[model samples]
Target: MASKPPDILLQGIDALRRVSRHMFRYRASIIAFFAVLLLIYGLYLRPPSDFPAGKTLSIPRGATLAEAARLLEEGHVVRSAHAIKIATYLFGGGTNIDAGDYRFPSPINALRIAYAITVGNFGRSFIRVTVPEGATVREIGALFALGTFTAFDYDAFLAAAKAREGFLFPDTYLFASAVTSDEVITTMQKNFLQKIGQLEPLIQSSGHSLADIVIMASLLEKEARSNETRRTIAGILWRRLEIDMPLQVDAVFGYIRGADTYSPSLEDLKIKSPYNTYLYPGLPPGPIGNPGLAAIEAAATPIASPYLYYLTDTHGIMHYSLTYEEHLKNKRKYLP
Candidate 1:
């Protein structure tokens, strides 16, 4: 084998030697070409010198990746739009960029920016807001308005949430500084569905429609504080509905007047509104406010009671009566 190398092998060795000599002759050019390529790559990865640190860049909802990159470049948050697009495509794993306000407290490279948008890293602090159990849509809007960081549109939220009064689940939510009215509405509605979904079987067997239950629960939420009292009130209210008697709940007046008073004036009670439970025979057109799980459960599983009337005294104690005269006596004793 070693006695004589094949002619082909000798030819290959000669070709390699020629190629090596050629490369050695032009090594400087090859090195310079690679060095230029690396320099360009490094520049692409670097943040712009005029980067808008401490500025917020808004990426509109439903915007494509290209649009987001353009916004970043235009806002001086990135060196180049093309570089960011390429970086996101290469590293984002085909995920859609999140839409919201992104604030940059400091300069960051293209790859970091791309990752931030792709993963929804808003780079802003979260505000913890608790929507109370009995809060109305307008009240919820006011609560969000108190947060200095939230850009929540109060009027927009009110308009959008008007029909979804009871469906907006009340809970503690940690919202980003840039949350929109639609986002808040969607989040609360989704949470309502999820929570209510768990009680679907109970609701189905209760012989009451979901709408009626929600409406009744809203009334119970304002009428009573304890779960036991809520269930008792629910029973009384349902009995009234069965007998074609007006609900006569005082809470709806507050909703009508956009006030927070449980006591309605005689003039206010005379107002002709569909929400007047004192005038209407059945449930009002819609829920007056949001209700918690306890109220909902009480409404869904009302306890059987023969009492036809009930009153909450000034001491917050509930009194139940079996006749109109007894109810009058309780009112006289409790009202003052």
Candidate 2:
């Protein structure tokens, strides 16, 4: 209006007005497109409607992210494998996912699943079970079976862990309610290796095979409750082995007959089993029970002592003697 604005300026204003009208006409369509994208993204984040509730999904060890995502999809745990992979890649900071059995009792989002696997946040309730030192494989199996949440298969555990008796480290473990026998065995054995790995130098320098040390420690574990007594007993046992003397440990009878008593009857000593240290002149064929770290260390580094005979009294007190006559006297004094 002021001097009839220049033609070029008028043309620019006309172009701007045309652009605004076009945007206003198509505003609803643009919003709908964005809403559709958001809906799709939200669906990708949710669990599949057919999710396998109360089912265990096993992720193999060392599985790649792609493989894990595929397994989650196949297990009906996620709506989209790609979404989980993206979520993990973004949030996990490129860490390896944990391998184990995962149970989803209810629906969970893909982001949650990603976080769980990345951080080993297994959603299942864990049952705390303590495997006592000196427990045999059978005893360990029974202990696990006693848990209300464990639904543990006693026979399967015994069968699988029979050969791994002493190698299965005894410790307090938190296991899933539906843990399998193989899983339990693997966990204990893995723990054993990890714990023993720390003492590798000591074990190597002791001039004794790991097997022998474990067997000796098993005996020490059953014979004495204190580290000092165990070390003393270990020295005595090693000296006896040098002279080819019978170990004559009564704990072997418990392994053979499944009896809890440490005092074997006169007849029980005569049993022909190779595990009978009284009948056999060397270390038992294998460890009678799992041993703790203190017992293991005592076996590896036995104290020098003159005592050859030792016994535990009814009150759990230990008596050490240099000769058989003194041992008998202590036995009479301490035994019931």
Candidate 3:
């Protein structure tokens, strides 16, 4: 009747119709399987829909895993408190989670979220912290506290720092927000040792001991405002000190006043701190600032020059002089 459809066309249509019927017969089972997958997804693999996500949550420094899990439940991040507790147990018992502030959406499940925080895989957003060239251990400790890392005790960290003096290399550090104070100090110490180890031969070649190199590097760090200036200043300092002249530095005065930068007061100059380079004939008892690689290298291999005097100019640039006359001229030109 339908123009007696072509024979081949008829056969194909009949086959397609049978397949469609069979598919419809299995549709309910397919839907049921999908439903189970959805449930599993919400519980273990992915987050539930229509839930507020990416809420800010901070885990205190000494907070336990149970506490973190409870906070998640309280924040409505996880629907079931009991389930989260059970999950924490199965996910390495919550002991593995690190201490830090975390941001997560409802788009992830408990296991995945816990793993993210513990293993530090949430995102790169690694915290960026810079320790300037000459920061002391106490100053370095304070920076950790400022970053919201609580496990660091200032007094304890100071003890550690003293034991590892001249070894806590100062440089920029990138770590997870949950990074501990001990970890940071340890890392710096290791770096310092490794770095100094590499420079040992150079130190020996300079006809100096390790302590001598450390002292020179410390002075170099205090004097350097730039890479080029560091080399220039190191030479002047070496030249003066070699001739029994005072290695006068203002950082010593700053140390006595518990300040890092300032114009010196008469009282500050008179303070009898061991770090008084102006008063003392040689390098201070220890370094005044944490030195970088460049300053350390400059201390080892200074620019050979005949200059004996150096001072900072009006533009903060350092000018060197070979004689008293030149030094006085530089001072008159630069000092207000």
Candidate 4:
């Protein structure tokens, strides 16, 4: 039998119908908003396949931003150029995106690419510049540039180096393209201070001034290519200095002639320059080369020995001689 519907049920039905009508009126707006969101998401989504999923990419020297973008897109790291720019912008503009080689896994997205460019690539583009033991400040600068820094007032560098001689640690250093010569110099000096600060007692106990240690270190540096050789060489140099004999280091002659290359000539030795130790009776006006830590240490605590002459053989091995006759024999055997 048909009975009258309850008032509450009828009211509920009416309310639902009114809400449905309102939703129909705004259907276009809802669809448009969702479509915009989809477009944005699709633009930035990384491609599924070639998305640099398994390999790191290299950004070689002189790479452009556009070229970098092309690489990322090919790797599927980014779906579109627009997406990469947007992601990079969010990652923080050109200032944030440091140019370097980057690695990306497959399915890497725009955000991942941006993050890699910003930070992950930092360690990838470094060059190692090794400053060998016994290199002078003048010598070190020359290694970086030839006549490029003719105006580079070495006065400041020399002033700093004179006080901190034999302290600049010899080691491998990593540097980015953005690094400057001044930065390198400061870094070496700082390393020197940290390293040599620990050897104050040794420098004092040797009854030698810091300059003396550096001078001895430079002399030792010229004579030794190994730790054992350095110790013995230090002894010989010390003995000659004590006896007031000519130090007669060929390196001093090379310095006088402004010669740093291999196999300096006989004529170079005869130059009447201030650095010629053969002509002058004492140490050179400056350190001959940058002295490494072992040479520096050997300079301070030399091995006690009675040998008067020592020479390196054809094999670059040293032969010690206690007398003139033995020295002549050594020269005849190895040098001849």
Q: After superposition, how far is residue 105 of candidate 4 from its true place, in Å?
A: 21
Q: lDDT per residue, candidate 2, 1-336, as tens digits?
A: 558889999999999999989988789789999988789766887778898877788898989889999999888898888888998987753648999888888988888899999898877888888989989998888777875554478898898899997999999999888788888999999999999988788789888999999999999998898999899999999999999999989889889998655568999989999999887899999999999898999999898899999988888888899999999999889988
Give, for candidate 1, the lowest lDDT window spanning 10 residues: 144-153
Question: Which stretches of candidate 4 lie above 4 Å from their native place?
Answer: 1-125, 136-167, 256-261, 264-266, 323-326
- Model 4 over residues 293-320: C-alpha lDDT tens digits? 7777888888888898898888898899
Candidate 3 displacement at residue 178 in angstroms: 3.3
Each candidate's lDDT (Cα)? 0.88, 0.88, 0.71, 0.69
Better of 1 and 3 by lDDT: 1
Please identify which of the two predictions, 2 or 3, would achieve the higher lDDT against the true structure: 2
Model 3 C-alpha lDDT per residue in residues 21-100, reported as the tens digit of each score: 99987997899999998887666445445344544566677777777777766766666656666666676655766766
Best candidate, TM-score: 1
Which 10 consecutive positions of candidate 2 have the poorest summed lDDT? 143-152
lDDT of 1 by residue, 217-334 (tens): 9999999999989998999999999999999999999899898765788887788999998776799999999998889999999988999989878888889999999999998888
Deviation (Å) of 150 in candidate 4: 19
* Per-model TM against the reference: 0.79, 0.74, 0.62, 0.58
